[model samples]
Target: MPYWRLSAYYFCYFAFVGAFSPYFTLYLKALSFSATDIAVLMSLMQVMRVLAPNLWGWLAEHLGVRLPIVRLSALMSLAGFSVFFFTDSFAGIFLGMALMSFFWSASLPLIESVTFAHLGTQGHRYGSVRAWGSVGFIVAVIGLGVVLDWLPIMAVLWGTASVLASIFLCSLAVPEAVRPLAHSASASLGDTLRRPEVKALLGACFLMSAAHGAFYVFFSILLVDHGYGKAMVGGLWALGVVSEILVFMFMPRLMRHYSLRAILLFAFSCAVLRFALTGWGVASAALVAFAQVLHGATFGAYHAAAIAAVNRWFAGRLQARGQALYGSLSFGAGGMLGGLVSGLGWETIGPAWTFTLGSGFALAGLLWLVWGWQPGLGEDGTDRPDGGGR
Candidate 1:
């Protein structure tokens, strides 16, 4: 695999997200959207994510055409995003985000599976290549933050659009890896999902991620209201991504030292703690800044472990579908639930208590996996390499 090209692909792709995630709310506000309206619109993207990835995965698997699907989706995402520039009406924005997310999400799981397919058992090093994405995210967040401080929020969108275009160009540079054919060493999804352990792992991920809704939907507004300037907000967000990048730089080492079970447990525990601090620490920049660093464990480690778990749990043609399942269940359903609940709680209770609820969810997920998950050894059903890395 040409890792530099693949990593460049991720960096450009995620740079768009870093810009979009933090500023889209501001854009909605500029278009005269209410808080609830912004939340709903943002949640719609998560909805598409839930509905689209599995279908795309199934298609990619059956057709054996993962690269074309990725490229086409990137192109469509660029086109769909243009709709926002023409009209800011609720229906227009909703339709546009739906179209973009539906296609935008079609690519990642397949790309992940493809990258790992190219790497085989050496997959743990996925982090080293992937960490470039975190760097891109940091640069975008802080750069746009400063830009937004002086310019219109709409400029952020344009900036993000340029980045997405760059991602499309980079996608073209990623040479496709040969995927295993449908007939090769197959285990159907039915066979994979039938196992109690797989179900339990998915369940844990869904519950914990769903719990994180409060922070995602309202964290920025909460900080802004707390008197932090746009630059400070951007800096704090970059701090989190910086930590994530650092972890990715060392993720293979982390995997080598820990079991998948241990990694999951630690990641969720960090979420439990991070959200608790973030929810109530609005008055303390230091507290919030420190909490942001936990992104390393909460998101970085957890995601890497989850993908590795998916890689191990499914073989051959089922790989793409497996990664999709993990994304749909966790980021999809989990994201919507979190946004909805946070929107509700932000108006009624407050940011602090809403985040407390997020911690509860992570804690529940941690507990579930700690007790319910036990992998069936390996192909030999014996102790393996801890299923640690690529």
Candidate 2:
């Protein structure tokens, strides 16, 4: 298993995210786009994920190969993003974002399936390998932040495009994993989705992503409005991921001691506190830093546990689709809703209230998880007859 190569892919892939997620909106702002317009553009990433991942997953499954599809997606996404260099008009930007997003969204889920397949029985080490991505994020976020202070905002375009090229390069080096044989009596995808625990898991994931909408769309802008510098904005984003890296490093120990359900519950609890502090505590630097630290629990631990759950629940032939479905519902559907709602509410309800609403979404997810999930469903699904474990 070319572990370092896979790690390199994750690093490059998330480096693009680190560059784009926090700074791209700021770039849009520099172009004098309104809050509504920026929101619509940013939401395109999530909207395309809703459709693209499932479509790409199906194709990969049909072809019985993932690496080729991953390579194609990476090439297409880079091509799609190039349109940004030539056009600043809203219509052109919108088209570019849509095309970029459709292809960009296809890579992660398929790669995740590949990664897990390579891991085989060593799935607990996923965090250690995945931690490189966080390191990449920290590098890009802080580096770009400092650069933006000196260079023009167009530097964001250049930096992101450079990373996208790296992603394609890395994709070329990752060898495909052997696909597992499908069992004749394996439960259909529809049957798997019908399970109560699966429903609760996906629902909670959706709401959790929704709860983060404001953070992704406006947290940097929020800090800037309150007199923070661009470099500081990058530092804060890096600080959150730094803590996330710690969580990922320790995740093997965490998995040994805690149930996936327990980790998820704690993560949701932190999300409530994190978003609230981010919204209401902007004036207090200490409070904001503390909130950022909670990112370990909210995103680092939460995502590790949630994706692990998806991997366990959706086994055998359904693996790729399961990952895609999880992405579509949670990050795609949920994030789109969060982005759109925050955009519409940013001016009307104000930033504080807008983020508080995010807290509400997290609270809803926490409650749903607690009420809907049964205890003692082991990670390998040993507790239930259907092998449905939490």
Candidate number of the best TM-score: 2
lDDT of 2 by residue, 235-326 (tens): 99999999999999999999999999999999999999999999999999899999999999999999999999888878777899999999
lDDT of 2 at 2: 80
The lDDT, on a scale of 0 to 1, for candidate 1 is 0.82
lDDT of each structure? 0.82, 0.92
Question: Residue 76's C-alpha lDDT in candidate 1?
Answer: 95
RMSD of 1: 2.6
Candidate 2 pairs with clashing backbones: none
Q: Model 1 Cα displacement at 34 (Å)? A: 2.3
| Candidate achieving the largest lDDT | 2
TM-score of 1: 0.94
